[model samples]
Target: MTAVIDKKKCNGCGLCALYCPLDVIYMEDGIGHVVYPDECWHCGACRQECAKGAVRFEFGAMMLAV
Candidate 1:
């Protein structure tokens, strides 16, 4: 499983990047995104920390519905 970044909902706040304990998130083109999907430990930290409701998880072909 991995975290997903919704481009439409993201405001480039960097909250996820700031909150991530693993330093997994970053900004590109003024958008918050995941840098290392494989490095994710599925801790659900970023998903819960995202204030704008932009971060979520995807397990295989099924995404965890927010």
Candidate 2:
């Protein structure tokens, strides 16, 4: 899984970065970015903490299969 931040919806609150348990998200130029997608635990903490609802998770095709 990977976290994708929508720039239009993001308000640069940095909450997503702060809430990421694995430190996968980072703040740059007042915007939250997924710097380490490979390290993501798919815990959804960042998405839950984002007040603007700018953070979203994208699962690979392989991951979608049960």
Among all candidates shown, the one with the greatest lDDT? 2
lDDT of 1 at 5: 97
Q: What does candidate 1's lDDT look like per residue over 1-66, in tens digits?
A: 888999999988887888888888888898888989878888878888788899888785445553
Model 1 poorest ten-residue lDDT run: 57-66
Query: Compared with the true structure, what per-residue lDDT tens digits does model 2 show for residues 1-66?
Result: 788999889989988888888999889988988988889988989899988989888987778995
Q: By TM-score, who's the top model here?
A: 2
